[model samples]
Target: MGTQAIIRPTTSQTAPAQEQNFGDQFLHVFLQDGTPVAKLGCGGSHVLNAAAGQSISNNRWTPITVQYNLPVGKQGGSCMIEIATDNGTAQRLEEYVSHPVSEVT
Candidate 1:
C-alpha cells in the first residue's frame, strides 16, 4: 500500500489565532481502486487514521498514530487535532497542540 500520506493544512489566506481552529479536519484514505476506503481521525494528529486497502476487516479499534504535521499560528502557535467518522458527519476527538513559541510576532 502507499506509505502513510501526510497532508498539511492548506493555507488560503492569513488567519487569526482563532481562525486557525481545525475542528473539522478529516483524514481521507483512498484504496487502490481510488475509492475512499476509510475516514479516520478528524483533524490529523494523535488519532487513528484509516488505512485504506490495508486488508483490515475489523473496522473497530484500528490502530492509528498521529503526529504534528505542521506548525500553525505564529512560531509556537496553538493547534488542535480532530477525529471525524460516520461519513464525515461526526467529530470524535479534539486535542490541543503546543510547541515552542515563535520568536517573531
Candidate 2:
C-alpha cells in the first residue's frame, strides 16, 4: 500500500461554525470499499479535520488530502500524515510546502 499527502494555502469555507471549540471543530470520515462504515463519532474514525477558527464566518477550511493504495493480495494499506497550523500572523496569507510526494513506503 501507498499514500501521499500535501499542504497548501486555501480560502474555502463550506459551512459556518456555531460552537467555537477544539472538540467541536473535529470532523470524521471512515470508508470501507468506498462506503461509509458508520456515523461519525460513533466509534473509530479514519479522518478528522479541525482547521480555520472558531466563529460563524467564512473562515478557511485548510483541507488536507490523504491518498492510499492497497495491493491486490496484500493485507495492509499505506497513507501519509499531515500537519497544518497558522503562521502567527494577523492575515494567514503565507504558506510553505515541500513539493508533492508521488509515493509512500
Candidate 3:
C-alpha cells in the first residue's frame, strides 16, 4: 500500500457561557502535500485553531464531519476553519486563528 498520513483522533473540550454564541463549527486540516481540509460543525468559541488556551464545549455539538486526504511527513502546512451560526458570520473570523495541523513525523 502507498504511504499515508496517520491522523490521530483529537477531541478538545470547553465550557462556554450560556449567553455566548454557540455557532457552527468548522475544522481545517493541513496536510503534508500543502493542501487544506475543511469540516463543518457547531460549538462555542467558533473558530477551530491552534491555541495555547482554548477548550471545546461539552454542551455544544456540531453535525459536520471533516475528512482529510493527504500524505504523511514531517513537513506539512497550516489550516484555518472558522465557526458561526451562519457562514457569513464565520467569514468574519476566517482571517484569524488559522490552525496549522502539521505532521509530527
Candidate 4:
C-alpha cells in the first residue's frame, strides 16, 4: 500500500505558508503490505535528497505527527516526521528541508 499527501500554503497568519514564487510541497510514501519502503518530497524545481530506509510497519490505527522549526529571517524550513507503529515504538523518519529560489538583490 502507498500513502501520499500534499502540503499547501494557506493565507492564514498562523499557518505554514510557502514562499512566494515557489510551488506547493508534495510527499509520497510507498509501502509493501504495510511495511514502509521509500518516501520522497518535492516542490517547485527541487527534490529532497534524503532516503527513507526505516523499518516501520503498522497494522492498526496509528498516529503520525510532523513538526517543523522554521527560524525567523530564513527563506526555508526543516521538518521532522514521526510515526507510531503497532509495536509501540515511534519511528522517526529522515528529516528534510526545503530549497527555494533565492531572491535577486
Top of the candidates by TM-score: 4
lDDT of 2 by residue, 1-105 (tens): 111222222244332212111231122322222221111111123232322221211233333222222111122222222222232111111122232322213
- Point out the worst 10-residue segment of candidate 2 by lDDT: 35-44
Give per-residue CA lDDT, model 1, range 1-105, as digits (tens).
Answer: 111332222232221111122354334443322212334332334343332222222223333222223234533333333322222332223344454332312
Worst 10 residues of 3 by lDDT: 13-22
Model 3, C-alpha of 61: deviation from truth (Å) = 11
The best-first sequence of candidates by TM-score reads 4, 1, 3, 2
Number of the candidate with higher TM-score, 1 or 3: 1
Q: Which segments of model 4 are wrong by more than 4 Å?
A: 1-24, 37-74, 94-98, 101-105
Can you rank all candidates by lDDT, best first? 4, 1, 3, 2
Top candidate by lDDT: 4
> lDDT per prediction?
0.30, 0.23, 0.27, 0.33
- How many residue pairs collide in each prediction? 8, 0, 6, 0
Runs of candidate 3 exceeding 4 Å displacement: 1-72, 86-88, 91-105
| Residues 40-75, model 4: lDDT tens digits | 243344443222333333333332322222211235
lDDT of 3 at 46: 34
**RMSD for each of the candidates:** 13.8, 14.7, 15.1, 11.5
Residue-wise C-alpha lDDT for candidate 3, range 27-92, written one tens digit per residue: 333321221223322222333432211222233432222222222233322223332321112321
